[model samples]
Target: MIKNVEIRQALPADAPAIEALYPAAFPDEDLVPLVRDLQELAAISFVGLANNGLVAHAAFTPCSLAGRGDNVALLGPVAVAPDRQRQGIGSALLRAGLRHLQNAGTGWVFVLGDPGYYGCLGFKPDDDVRPPYRLPEEWRGAWQSLSLSEHKTPLRDQLTVPQAWRRQALWTPYGL
Candidate 1:
C-alpha cells in the first residue's frame, strides 16, 4: 500500500540524495549530472520524504515561449527511489511542485512524460505551444502542458528551454 509521503522544497543539503535517486530509479541512465546542472541553473527543486529519508525528487526550471518572456516552467527529471515506485511518491512530488509554481506566479508548466500519468495531473497535449526541439513522430503526444494560472488560456508559442535542456538529443521518446 502507498503511504503518505511528506513533500517539501528541497534544501541545499539534500543534493546528494537527489543525485542518487536518478541512478536508483533509472539504472541505465546516469542522470545525476543532469540533476545537478538543473539545480545549478536555479531550478525550483522539491523532495518527497517518508520514514525520515528522501523518497522522490522533482524540479521545475524556467523556459520561454519564443518572443514571450520566461513565464513558463519546465517540469521534468522527476524521479522516485526504486523502492518507492508505485507508492504515489512521484505524484506527491509533482503536485507539490505545481503548487509551488502556482504560488510563485508561474503561468504554465510543460512536461514530456507518460501521457496517461500526466493526464491524471491535468496536463494535456497542447498543439498551441510546441517544444524547443522537434520530438520523434511517435513521441509527439508526449509533450504535454498544464496551466497553473487563474486564466486557462490556450498557449501560443514555441518553447525555448534553458541552454542545458536545449540539446536536441534530450528530446526523445526513450525515457521520461
Candidate 2:
C-alpha cells in the first residue's frame, strides 16, 4: 500500500509520471500514441498519487455505438506503479474515474480487460450485441460493458470502432 495516495483527475503536469509508469508496466510496446489517443479522446483522465508522485493512472475516453447510437465511454491504459501492484490503487483509480464519467452524463462504459477484475465493478459482456471491431476470440468474453443510465436501452445490434482505431490490424478478424 502507498503511504499517502490521493486519487484525482490527471493534469498536464502528470504526463511525465504517467508516461514513466507506462513503460514500467508495459515494456513490450511503445505506448506514446495510445497515451496521446487517450488524452485526446477521454472525457476525463484520472491518476493516483503518493508522496506527491503519481502511482496509478486511468482514462475514460468518449465513445459511441454506430447506427443505434448512444453516448458511451471507454476505459483504458489503467496502470499502477510496479511496487504498488495488488494494493487496490488501480481499483480506486477506476472507481473514481467511472463515477466521474457517469456523473458527467456518459451513458455507458466499455473496457477490454480481465473480466474477473472488471466484473467486480459491475461490467458484463453484451453477448447479444456485436461490435464492428472484431476483438480477439479470447477477448470476446472479456469485452465487458456497464451502463450508467438509469433507464437501460438495448445495446446496438453492432458496435463500431472509431475510424482512427479501425485501421489497426488488431481489430481485424484474423488478428482478432
TM-scores for the candidates: 0.93, 0.85
Q: What shift in Å separates residue 146 of candidate 2 from its native position after superposition?
A: 0.8
- Highest lDDT, which number? 1
- As a TM-score, model 2 comes out at 0.85
lDDT of 2: 0.74
- Those runs of model 2 whose alpha carbons end farther than 4 Å from true positions after fitting are 1-3, 67-69, 161-164, 167-176
RMSD of 1: 1.9
Error of 2 at 133 (Å): 2.0
For all candidates in order, the CA lDDT equals 0.84, 0.74
RMSD (CA, Å), each prediction: 1.9, 3.2
Residues 34-142, candidate 2, lDDT per residue (tens digit)? 7766666543789999887888988776766764456787777678888988888998888888888888888888876678888989999767566656776777867
Best by TM-score: 1
